[model samples]
Target: MEFLNDYLMIIIWAVVLVGTILIEFETSDLVTIWFSVGAIGALIAAASNVNFFGQIAIFIVVSLVLLALTRPLTKRFMDKEVIKTNADRTVGMHGVVVTEIPFDGKGEVKVDSQIWRAFTTQKDPIPVGTRVVILDIVGNKLLVDVLKEDL
Candidate 1:
């Protein structure tokens, strides 16, 4: 009992530091890092013979202060940029219908030397060999329109 009372704050702070560091490594969210720093502050207080309540107060104050001060700056630095893909380049390009496009069903089109599943909103069926203009891609399918002259 006496040994535990003497070292209790030190043990608790050490455990908190290790646990927060492990959690920070697993998540990489820049959150638990503040708590680990807080645990370090508490550990220092305990080592310096600060009262138990004072150590707890130091931990809370340090953690909250660091979180409030740095989280927004860290978030801005961590924001990811949107990336363009090769598939995105297909929009606005022209293609030829390789299979008859039934008004209610999907069809295949040949665009830029590659074949893609295509769909159209036109009420009439599109015949094979008709020219189509790629509009947008949905999932693995392309949304297309008949070329103006093909109407």
Candidate 2:
């Protein structure tokens, strides 16, 4: 009982360190990485004969400092959304051919409120009133394909 009481700090530190590392691994979201490092610091302090309150204070301070320093940086790189341009916004959108688009030729397509110069993949001419999907934007033109009803 006396041995367990004397080594309680070591036991707590071991449990905290392992538990935090496991949680970090499971989540892989950087949520518990700071705490895992802090637990290691606390474990080192406990091993060096630091008292319980001092170990806890060290753990809290280290964890908070690390979290503040790295959390935003991690999120900035991880949660980045794709930057879209005015033309890029039309990709995968359905449009109607407003002018005949023959192979190796140009035409116009109206998607929503915007009319864009468009071209089609089909070798046959895509006449007016045909439904198409924007595939890509090339300079001042839109590359499009016929849209199947099921898609």
Candidate 3:
């Protein structure tokens, strides 16, 4: 019975660790801070032979405390960099279509010394060598609208 309790704590800790990693990967959101604390608390409880209920209580309390304490710090850190990547930095910039972009699918554009996959916002196809204005970023692709004069 005692062994089962310890094993359960260990399992809970392992689950917390895995959950944190998966959440961090999927959304890149800052939600795993408390999960990491819960994992650590469960690990400590297991090592110290703490009872099952005690372990759960400790995990919850520690997780909440750490989350509250670190939320402001994490927010500050995340907000400090307004744009972390070159792609994020180029959302509103103008670019030239290097390849003809079909209305149905993908195309390429050159912006700020970089070539990027781009998509047309209009129904008609945009030809190569046309000037385009980037409207927004959709993942790795740029949403673009052609310049009126190029139409």
Candidate 4:
């Protein structure tokens, strides 16, 4: 009990450091790592016989400084380009209607040697072999439009 009384702040800061590191591992998002660093600062202050409030102030200042200084560099490393899927590549592409598309219903269109369920907003039914333009995808269906002969 006497030993704890003398080292309570040190123990608390050590626990905080371990807790923050565990949280950082669970997320890996650079979120709690700053707190872990701050805990290290507080631990140093505690070991130096600083008062509890001074230790807390050291923790806050260290965490804020590290966050402000390193956030942009971390963001640059973390931000990644989104890769497009095969389905996403089909947008704004041309396809052929393989089956007659009933008005306001689904049909099949062939694009890049692949057959896809497709639909259109046109009032009339699109005939088989009609050239179509893939506008977008809704679920597994392709939203299409009639491709005009002139571009």
Q: Write down the TM-score of every candidate.
A: 0.55, 0.51, 0.60, 0.57
Candidate 3, residues 34-123: lDDT per residue as tens digits? 877687877888879987788789888988998889888988877755556766778778899999999989999999989999997689
Q: In order, how many clashes per candidate?
A: 0, 0, 0, 0
Question: 125, model 3: CA deviation in Å?
Answer: 2.4
| C-alpha lDDT of all candidate models, in order | 0.92, 0.87, 0.84, 0.91
- Residue lDDT tens for model 2, 12-128: 888998898888889888788899889889988888888779998999999999999998899987785767777788899999999999998999999987999998778888889
lDDT of 3: 0.84
Lowest summed lDDT over 10 consecutive residues: which window, candidate 1? 1-10
Candidate 3 TM-score versus the reference: 0.60
Name the Cα RMSD for model 3: 4.7
lDDT of 2 at 59: 98
Which candidate ranks first by TM-score, i.e. highest?
3
Candidate 2, residue 138: the lDDT equals 86
User: Residue 100 in candidate 1 has what lDDT?
Assistant: 85
Ranking by TM-score: 3, 4, 1, 2
Q: How do the residues 1-151 of candidate 1 rate in per-residue lDDT, one tens digit apiece? A: 7557648878989999999999999988786999999999999999888888999999999999999999999999978897878999999999999998888899999999999999999999899999999999988899999999777
